[model samples]
Every structure is written in structure tokens, then in C-alpha cells.
Target chain A: EAGVAQSPRYKIIEKRQSVAFWCNPISGHATLYWYQQILGQGPKLLIQFQNNGVVDDSQLPKDRFSAERLKGVDSTLKIQPAKLEDSAVYLCASSYGPDRGTDTQYFGPGTRLTVL
Target chain B: AQRVTQPEKLLSVFKGAPVELKCNYSYSGSPELFWYVQYSRQRLQLLLRHISRESIKGFTADLNKGETSFHLKKPFAQEEDSAMYYCALSRSNYQLIWGAGTKLIIKP
Candidate 1:
């Protein structure tokens, strides 16, 4: 089966600029998530969506980061006025359902973003 | 707060040697543990989970609540075993708290 797909596997932008990453979850998957993984660190969730409705986004920086899962199949995460510290790999994952952690999460290749 | 710790940043083992990747977590309720592996040029994938109690690729991890650890172990390592392994704990059965990750290198 096809796994989660992401676009522009790598990106580079200047500070205070805007950058956006796109993600398309696995077919028939119902839960989607976006995570930021800094170098030498594990992934930190930025947002989660269940069938086009937001499930959680507490870790998201509302001032500059935003994400949307329109039509419940695709998602986009955007960061405006980016900062140097925002340079990290952005991963997208999806699960068959919101099984509260039991379901296996399939991840994408991730987009490596560098802010100068 | 909930957190996961991988004491070792990097672990090197010879082929056919034993391998162990330590993982510890802090949580209040009954936590679900998972080990995820990311090979070079590959996406992150589930290696195993505590609930499943099944070994994958000859690797097994046993969750010890008293010790608050779920260490991944394999009696015999292979060259293809080289990868980044992450330990994660389910928080409130909804979110996951992940460890920094351990880079495993199996020398031929």
C-alpha cells in the first residue's frame, strides 16, 4: 500500500519569510498529524486532525504556525515570519483511525526546512 | 510532566553481537510504549509495541513498569540493523511523548 506523501522534500527560506509544507495521508486513513523534528531530537507534534476536524494543536505556535486538513485527505502546515530555530524536519503521519495510540502511524519522508 | 528518555545518543555493536537500546519514560497512568525505527532514506516505522508483545526482526522490548523502562534488545545484530530508534510513551492515551532517539550502528 502507498504510504503518506509529502511535497518538496527539502526547503530553504530566509528569516521573517513564509514557508509552507504539504502532506497527503494514506488512503482511507482517518487521523492525520504534523510533527516538527529538530536535529538530534525526536518529533514534536504541531497539530492533529481527525477527518477535517482538529483534534489537538496545543503545541502549535499560534502566533506564526498554522495547519489545515481540508477535505479530510490532505494537509498543509505553514510558518510565517520564520525564525532560525524553525529549521527542522517536518513530518506528516496518518493512522487508520483515532485509536488513542493503539493504531500504527505511517509517516512520510518529511520535508527538511532551513531558515537562514 | 510526561517525558521519554534515551540515555544513549549512539550505540555501536558488531555483527552477531548482542544489542540493547535503553528507553525510560515518566507518566502517571498506564502508559503504552512503542519503538519506532528510521533507516537511512526511509520513513519512520513502528518496530514494535508493548501491547503487541511480538518481536519484529529478531528484536524484542519488554516494558518494566517498576523500572519505567522499555529497552529494545536483540541477541544477534545484523548490518541492516543500523538505524535510529525512538522510544515513545502514550500520554493520556492520545498524545505521544518521544525520546531523543538512539543511533544504532552495527559494524560488519
Candidate 2:
């Protein structure tokens, strides 16, 4: 079975520029998530979606970061006015269900964003 | 607030030596725990979950609710065992709270 897929494995943008990352989750998966991994740190959850509705986004930077999963199959995470601190790997993950005991998340290759 | 902590940033051991990666979590209620590994140039993948009580690639972890710790361990480390390991706690909605990863190096 194919795993989660992400576009533009690497990206570079100047500070204050806008950048967007796309993710296509595994087939039949019901939950999708976006995470930011800074160097030498674990991935931090940015937002989570169950189908087309958001489940949690408390950690998301509402001032500049936004994410959406319109059809429940694909998702996009956007960061406007990027800052140097935003340079990190953007990972997309998906799970077959929303139950912690029964579902394990599968991660994508991730997009490495470098802000100049 | 839920959180996971991996105290070690890097660990090195000779092949055939025992290896342990420490993980501690802070949560009031019972939370599912997991260990994830990422090999060089590979995506992050689940190594093991506390609920399954299964070993993967000679690695095993036991959840100690009394100590709030779930440390990954292997009796004898292999060169191929070198990788980045992360401990995570699963929330009710299936969202993961990850620890700062530990990089293991098994030397010959």
C-alpha cells in the first residue's frame, strides 16, 4: 500500500514571503495531521483534521499559519510572512482511524522549508 | 498539558553493548505511548506501541505508569540499530505529543 504523499520535498523562500505545502494522505485514511520539526527536535503538531473538519489546532500560529482539508483526503498548510524561525521540515501524517489504540500514523517524506 | 521528554540528545555505544533510550511523560490520565524511528533518508515510522507489548528489531519498551516513563531498550545493540528515536504520547483524538528525539550511534 502506498504511504502518505507530499509535494515539493524542499522549498526555499525569503523572509516575509508566503509558502504553502501540500499533502495527500493514504487511501481510506480518516485523519490527517501537519507537524513542524525544527532541527534537532521532534515534530511539533501544528494542526489535526478528522475528515474535512479540524479536530485540533491549538498550537497553530493563528496570526500566520493556516491549514485546510477540504475533501478529507488532501490537505494544505500555509505560512504567510515567513520568518527565519519558520525554517524547518514540514511533515504530513495520516491514520486510518481516530482511535489511539487501533491506529498508527504513517508519515510522509516531509518538505524542508528554508527561509532566507 | 501533555508532554514527552527525551533527556538525551545523543547516545553512542559499541556494537554488542546494551542500549537504552530514556523517555518520560507528564499526563494526568492514562495515555497510549509509542516509539518512532527514522533511519537515514527514510520517513518516520512507528517502531512500537506500548499497548501491543511487542518487540521490533530487538527493541522493546515497557510502560511504567508509576514512574510515567516508557524507555526503549535492547540487550545488544547492532550497527544497523543506529537511528533517530522519538517517544510520543497519544491523545484521545489520536494526536501525538512527541519528545525531542534521541540519536543513537552504534559503533563497531
Candidate 3:
């Protein structure tokens, strides 16, 4: 079976520039998530979506970050006016809905964003 | 506030030796814990969950509520076992708190 997929495995941008990352989850999975992993750290949850609606985004930087799962299958996370501190790997993950006894999340090959 | 702690940033063991990666967490209510692994150049994937009570790739973890710890263990470590491991706690269905992660290195 195909796993979660992401685009632009690597990206570089200058501070104050904008960047976007895309994700395509596994088929039939109902939950999608975006995470940020700074070097030497584990991935931090940035946002989550169930179907076409957001389930949680409390950690998202509302002033600079935005994400959308319009059709409920694919998602895009964007950061505007990127800062040097924003340089990190952007990871995408997905899971089968809660109905499944074990909601194991599968992750994609993250996009490494380097803001100079 | 929920938190996951991995005390060790790096651990090394010889092949055929036992391996343990320590994890501790802080949560008030019922806690759900998970272990995720990422091999070199691979995406992070679930290794095990406390609720399952099942072992994967000879690795297992038991949640100790009394001490607030969930440590991953494996017997007879192999070179293939070298990877980064992360312990996480679920705050909600869609939210998870993760530790800094531990890098396990197995010597031949």
C-alpha cells in the first residue's frame, strides 16, 4: 500500500520570504497532520485535520502559518514571512479514523526548509 | 501541560545485547503512550503503543503509571536496530506531545 506522500523534499528561502509544503495522505485515511521538527528534536504537532475540517491547530502560529485540507485528502501548509527560526523539517502524517482500534499514524518523507 | 521526556540523547550497545530506551511523561488523566522509530533516511513510523500490549520487531514497552514511565526494550539488539526513537503522549485524538528523541546505535 502507498504511504503518505509529500512534495519538495527540500526547500530554501530567505527570511521574510514565503514557503509552502504539500502532503498527500494514504488512501482512506481520515486524519491528516502537519508537524515541525527542528534539528536534534522530535517532530512537533503544528496542525491536524479530520476530513475537510480542522481538528486541532492550537500550536500553529496564526500570525505566520496557515494550512488547509480542502478536499479532505490532500493538504498544504504555508508559512509567510519566514524567519530564521522557522528553518526546520516539515513533516506530514496520516492515520485511519478513530473507528480503527489502533490509529497508528504513517508519516511522509518530510520537507526540509532552510530559511537564511 | 503534557510532556514527554527521553533522558538519553544517545545510546550504544553491542549486537546481541539487550537494549532499553527510557521515556517519562507528565499527564493528569489517563495517558496513551507510543514509541516511534526512524531509520536512516526513513520517515518516522510507529514502533509500538502502550495499549496494544504487543511487541514489534522484538521491541516492547510497558507503561508504568506509578513512575510515569514508558521505556522501550528489545532483546538481542541488531545493527538494523540502529535508529532514532521517540516517545509520545496523546493529548487528544489529534494532538500528541513528543520527546526530544534517542538515537540508538548498535555495534557489530
Candidate 4:
């Protein structure tokens, strides 16, 4: 099976600008996740989706960040008014799961966002 | 609140030597631990999980519930083993708490 795929391997935008990233999860994966990994740190969960419905987004900054997994096959994460602190690698992962975090997750080459 | 901690930010060892990466977690219930690795320019991949009691790529981690640790170890380190390793704990709610990660350098 192919791994998760992500678009825009690298992006640079000025502060307050908006940026979007796309992800295609592995075939038949019911759970999709978006994470933000800062330099020198581990990835933090931004949002989680289970078959087109959100399962978790408590850590997401609702004011400027949003994500959607329409149709449960593809997902898009958007960051509006990107701040310098938002400069990080945006990672996408998926698993054969129904909101099971213990499932082995297949990852994609993350999109590195640079907010200047 | 559940949390994962990797005390060493970086560790360097010579090739063919033993390697150990420390990990400690805090959770109320029985924890599901995992070790993930990322090589240069590669996507992060799961190396092993505590539930299976299996070793991958010559690496093994014992989940010591009494000590609250799951330390990854390999008998003989290879240059190819150099990468960033992350320890994660699965919470009761099925969410994950991740550690900052440790960068392992295998010197040839």
C-alpha cells in the first residue's frame, strides 16, 4: 500500500498570510491526523478526523487554524494569519482505525511551512 | 494529564557499540508505548510498540510499568541507526502524548 501523500513540500509566507496544505491518506484508512512539529520538538496533534467527521481538535487554535476531511479520503489544513510561531513542519498521518490512537500510523513527507 | 519525556536531547555513540535511548512517561492507567524514528529526509516510521513485545531493526524496548519507562536499546549500533527517535504514550482517551525526541548519532 502507498504511504500517505502530502503536497507543497515546502512553503514560505509572510506573517498574517494564509496557507493551506493537502493530504491523501493511505487506501482504506479511516483515521487521518494533522500535526505540527516545531524545530527541536515532537509533533503535536492539530486535528484528527474519522471518516469525514472530526474526532479531536482540542489543541487546535480555532481562531486561525481549521481543517477538513471531506469524504474521508482527503484532508486539508489551513492556517490563516500565520504567525512566526506557526513556522513548523505540518505532518499528515493515517491508520486503519476508527479513532484508535494505538493503531500504527503511516506518515507522509511533511510540508515545511516557513512564516516570515 | 499524560505526558512523555525523553531526557536526552542528543546522544552519540561509536559504531558497533551498544545504544540506549531513555524514555519516561506519566499516565494514570496501563500505557501503550511506541517508538518512532525519522531518518534524514524520510517520513517518520514506527519502530516498535510495547503491546506486541517485539523488536524491530535490532531495537527492543521493555515497558517497565513499575519504573514508568520504556527505554529503547540495541546491542550493536550501526551508522544507519542514526536518526531522530520519539517516544509516545497512548492516553486512555486514545490520544497520544509525545516526547520532544532524541537525536542519535552513530559515529563510524
The number of the candidate with the highest DockQ is 2
**Where's the lowest-lDDT run of ten residues in candidate 4 chain A?**
A96-105
Candidate 2 DockQ vs. native: 0.86
lDDT for model 1, on a 0 to 1 scale? 0.93
Cα error of candidate 3 at position A78, Å? 0.8
What TM value does chain A in model 3 reach?
Answer: 0.97
For model 3, the superposed segments whose C-alpha errors exceed 4 Å read none
* Model 4 per-residue lDDT at A5: 96
lDDT of 3 by residue, A16-109 (tens): 9999999999999999999999999989889989999998898999899999999899999999989999999999999886767456889999
- Residue-level lDDT of model 2, residues A1-116, one tens digit each, is 99999989999999999999999999999889999999999999999898999988999998999999998889999999899999999999999874443569999999999999
Docking class of 2: high
Against the true structure, what is each candidate's TM-score?
0.97, 0.97, 0.96, 0.97
Give the alpha carbon lDDT tens digit for every residue of B23-63 in model 1.
Answer: 99888899899999999999999999999999999999999
lDDT top scorer: 2
lDDT of 2 by residue, B1-108 (tens): 789999999999999999999999998778899999999999999999999999999999999999999999999999999999999999877778899999999999
The runs of at least 3 residues in candidate 4 whose Cα sits more than 4 Å from the true structure, single-residue gaps closed, are: A99-102
- Each model's TM-score for chain A is 0.96, 0.96, 0.97, 0.96
Per-residue lDDT tens digits for candidate 4, residues A1-111, read: 789999999999999999999999999999898999999999999998988989899999999999999988999999998999999999999988744444788899999
